[model samples]
Target: MALDTGMKCIKYLLFIFNLLFVISGCVLIIVGAVIEANYRTYLDFISSSYLSAPSILIAVGVLIFVVGFFGCCGAVKENHCMVVTFVVLLFMIFIVQLGVGIASYILSNDVERFLHENMLKSMRNYDRSRPGVIKTWDVIQHDHACCGTNNYEDWTSTPYGEEYNGVPDACCKEHVSGCGRNIFNFSQKLNDINKEGCFDKLKGDVEENVTILGGIAIGIGFVQLIGIAFACCLAKSLKRQYETV
Candidate 1:
């Protein structure tokens, strides 16, 4: 027996939902990749665990494509089994996405303390011969156009800061060899050096990015719920049709 008009509409709606799922999957993949890249730049200031959220997002995104295809096929073939499987898989993805959203929010709140402590520890390593340490600090200082963790004064406690008599050369507003030497106080050479601290700058940027990630995850999760509903209704219709046959 053919489906009633309402059932026919539900079938088409399920197909539309599956298409939306595929598009959202692409969006998640892009979001995950971009956030992961941003996190790498600040790896020195963050814990390695932070990377897992984005990595999972990418994985979930890939799984969505496969599950969405199954949903599409189920809706087209009017197969109760396939539609039910799609609903289960989508629910699993929804749970994962929700978890990621919550984790990102918690991480965002803890970022300030985490960055302050880690940045200070990393600053002490600046004077060492480690190229990675040197480059990380220099990149942060130069790229952000800021000085030490809290201020240029924060560097004075470090050997490199004492050796330079002020802050690292990367803290100079204009890149001049030895320009940062002997420069102390904002009044000494107001235009010559960056008196602002890197902590505040980095903290603000990181929090904003993390918040965006959380929003995306939660947003996608809610949309998945709708797709799950549509799939379930269609599965019910198919089951009833089979009973009458």
Candidate 2:
């Protein structure tokens, strides 16, 4: 009688786990579908600097849902075959995610390098004579230009032709040459450039997030596999008990 009671308890637990797994899986699937559908929109948002982080979260959410569903079904059926299948699926997902994350990191690094190199070249070739280019240069320079003032001398004190002490007039000249404008104007332009870059970075972050989500889904799937194993053991034990009775 005690053996029968234990079997009944084990069955009930398996049933509960299966139901929960199914529900979670469904939710994940829905979430993944939504994210997949809006992937372009999310990328656009990153491009616009409106949002950071994308696709990864959605992908992970989807995986979680699918794996959970499989786990639930396996538990309900007490089928070791399904449980093993789910485990294999999870392992594959994990491997794929690891590959993607590494690839993305490499790609982003390459892109950053390219952008930095090109921007440097563009700055060097910039035509200061062109009004638009000059204006743009001035905006960029003023914002990023840095100068240090000596404690012993006041920069504002040198009015008109008064010889400025400590600080070199060449400093201002360098700033003007680099940005093609005064610091104040350059600062504003720099801000605009930074805003655009921020958006691009956010998009990259979204892809990274997808990889992270995949890792997490893999973990959850692993746990579900353990649960399925436990369920199988319980089912076998119950069967043995019933046979003895």
Candidate 3:
């Protein structure tokens, strides 16, 4: 009777854990989607391959839902095979998530130079006629409160620089018609325009995103350990019960 009661408690705990898994799955999906959308906004500055982390997270979220179902059914029915399979799936996913989290953190350290190169390349190709380039640069400058890849002076060599003799109006501290005109004048430049580079600001943002992703992945992976242990205990109890019967 004591053993049966203990096994029953473990089964109920597993059921509860599975419910939490379902909720975590939903949260993971949302996190992945939000991050992916953010990255898309800066697609011109980032490699498409950088998207794989979020994509994997989204897939893992869906897989968690399936694994949760298996866990719930196995616990409810005391099905040994289902419970063992749940453990296997949970363990495999835990490893994958941990690996991705570590990899993301390591990659974050190296993204600065890559992003700088891309930022400069995109800046060189900037043209009003190219709406994509124009909009991206304008949005980046205005939103980040930054002027060029390195500094406001960096734009002085661009085609737009030749025409305007100053930074883009988006770089103006207090935007007004032609506020950026003649900003090369040291006093006016300091007073009217943002002097910082977009590269450092953007690099920090990207690194922060990846770091958050890493933290979430590793955190969830460790949390899944509890579920794995519960599944294993339940599977073993079920196996013993079957042998005795």
Candidate 4:
């Protein structure tokens, strides 16, 4: 009777974990699908460098969720072989989640650093009198000339282009209208604008996906630990059942 009770407890715990996993998994899948749908928008808003990998991470999250659902079912049935199979599959999912989380962290950090350094360098070389403030500005202008057409035209022609123009003034500093001009102020202003833009992109991406990713990571970690505990308890119960029989 005690052995049976123990087995029942394990089954209940497995059910609970499975339910939680399914719910979280479904949420993750939905979020991933949304991101995949608007991937181009994300790429255009944020750095495209991180887009491919994050999309893959989302796909993996969806797969783990589906696998987790099956594992839960297997555990609830009290089929020893099925239980073992579930455990093995859960372990694999945990491993993959860990790897993907780590990769995402590293990739995000690298991208952040690149943006920071590049923006600073561009700001340091900004010249108001020049065609564009810094390298990044030049790149943005070249790529998005039509996107910011009105602002670009104003910046290029007007005397107080740095002030009256719709473009962020920080990127468009005043250039002394003479020969042998010093552009230190112009460079500083450009860097500030680049920094602002970099931060904006980072914030936008985080707003879009950080919460969903974080929830999946936490949910998966919790499920894996609980699943392991339940598996151990189930194994002990099975051992007792065999001894009694």
TM-score of each: 0.78, 0.40, 0.80, 0.55
- Model 4: lDDT equals 0.54
Q: Rate the local accuracy (lDDT) of all candidates.
A: 0.83, 0.46, 0.83, 0.54
Clashing pairs in 3: none
lDDT of 1 by residue, 1-245 (tens): 57889888888999988987788778879989987887554443334455587888798788988898889889888889999999999999899889989999988878788879878887887765755567777888999999998988888888887787677889999988888877764466756988899998888887898899899989989988988988888889889989989
Error of 1 at 50 (Å): 4.5
Model 4 segments more than 4 A misplaced = 1-3, 100-111, 117-223, 239-245
Candidate 2 residue-wise lDDT, 1-245, digit = tens: 34356655665665576567557656665765665565434333112232233345556556656765665575556555565565566556656655665565556545555444443333333332433333433343334342221211222233211222222222243433333223233454333221222223333555566556555645654655555565556656645655787
- For candidate 1, report its TM-score: 0.78
User: Model 3, 115: alpha-carbon shift in Å?
Assistant: 2.7
**Residue 55 of model 1, lDDT score:** 84
Per-residue lDDT of candidate 3, residues 39-64 (tens digit)? 55454443446558788779878999
Q: 1 or 4, which is superior by TM-score?
A: 1
Best by TM-score: 3
Flag the better candidate by lDDT, 1 or 2: 1
lDDT of 2 at 177: 31
lDDT by residue for model 4 (1-245), tens? 34466578778878787777777777767777777675534343223454575576577667767766675766666556666666777777777766666555556555545655444443333444433343345455434322122233333333333433334333333322231122224554333232223344443455436445655665666658778778767756765666787
Cα deviation of 100, candidate 4, in Å: 4.5
